[model samples]
Target: MKNRRLSNLKYEITKNKSTLLAIIFLTLIILISIFAFLIPMDPSATNTSNILKPPSASHIFGTDELGRDYFVRTIYGGRGSLIVGVLAMIISTSIGVAIGTISGYFGGWVDNLIMRSVDVISSIPWMILVTVISIFLKPGLQAIIIVIGLFSWMETARLVRAETLSIKEREYVLYANSIGETSWRIITRHIIPSVFPTIIIAATSSIAGAIMTESALSFLGLGIQPPTASWGNLLQNAQSNLQSSPYMAILPGILIVFTIYSFNKVGNVLRVYLEPKVAER
Candidate 1:
């Protein structure tokens, strides 16, 4: 079954040129980030004499204001950025699925209570809320991830809750309930599987949002601190030298844009493939 699924995925990618390119870019970026440590240049090491040099044979992406290798720093930054995005997605998705499943499966006051809470939380401007919360926490990867993950789960929760509401009323779920299967078992065995595709679609969007949020936070100096090599902080560092060394800002900005764009593309493709009725629209 897994092999067949994998084969179908490959077929889909091959048939869609845009998705194929997006996947390739995403894969290359992920691989490069994972193996970044293998490269010899130290992202944090500074050379006062080499500061703000333009791209050259020795430094493909040039040097930053701190005289650190911009290429190496950007690579390392991707590692940190992608880590925060992926981990935060996992945290948000877990919270969303659990709460959504409980609220939907139980219905009545449980649903109303959960939905109202989601609404209350969603009313606040999340970026402002995340920024205010981040100010209290120490600036680092984990702090940024936690802030983004917590604030970002509401949408996913709502999506899952809607899906779960419809799924719980289905014949199979009704059959399970009639057979005296525990609510927990019905949710775990039937509802979750039914909602998994929705979760996947939400997860892809969550990852993109998380990465963009982290970048924004770091740009404001509230996220990963300097010398840590996050893409956001890299852009922050380059902001002062925008005229003298625009490449410094442009490089990381391009990376963040492309990464987010690629994720969005992949999500769209997945939505089309997974939800056939929507595709027909």
Candidate 2:
């Protein structure tokens, strides 16, 4: 009976529509990443013969100006985009959660210093900051990831700090402190676990934002240098020949829109499930 109850609880956590959609989309992205390495098509191969070709059996998503297969490029491009997004999320969330947890739990001077630093960073325009950094550093996947990760953490820090403050004030936390538990032990066992659900939901939502930021940077020629493909770079190519071969641009744009939409749907679902509903007085 106890085992059955545990299994049911696990099923409840996994069975939500948002969780399912997130899993499916994540799986699809992963498959695309693997396909990038396994697929036969040379993403950089140019077939002048098939230049600007529309979607056909031979070239699934058709060929671009350089006669490269759109389908293959899209898959390959997705690999880079997903990698940057995931890595950026990991970096930002780790830094944010640590700082937020410490600041909220300690309060006083520590909270003021961290919050003031966050405010300074938050005041700048993220895109411009990224662009400036990209200029100083080489423009590539790593550069974009670092830039986005650094700038994006403020929001996560603020969110985590708020959640941590609430959790730290709980009677359970006080009881653990009364029992002479070490600060680190109390924080890890109580505060972090309580705030983790919010962190997860926030992280999932941040991916969509990261993708858009990367796309914008790539579109501006400051992201993912040539010989590499991204949705943004693909769209950049489409700008010149938009009138003649709109498909060249439209396909990648469509994919970007769909990817962002999928992420938003999943994020919304998770937010609803994880957040507590307030009772009316």
Q: Which candidate wins on lDDT?
A: 1
In model 2, which range of ten residues has the least summed lDDT?
272-281
| TM-score of decoy 1 | 0.94
Per-residue lDDT tens digits for candidate 2, residues 236-259, read: 888998887888778778777767
Q: Which parts of model 1 have CA positions greater than 4 angstroms off?
A: 1-11
Clashes of 1: 0
Question: What is candidate 2's CA lDDT for residue 279?
Answer: 10
lDDT of 1 by residue, 163-271 (tens): 9999998999999999999999999999999888799899999999999999998998989997798999998988899998999999999999999999987886676
List TM-score per model, in order.
0.94, 0.87
- Assess the local accuracy of residue 177 in candidate 2 as a C-alpha lDDT between 0 and 100: 86
Worst 10 residues of 1 by lDDT: 272-281
Cα lDDT listed for each candidate: 0.89, 0.80
- At residue 59, candidate 2 shows an lDDT of 84
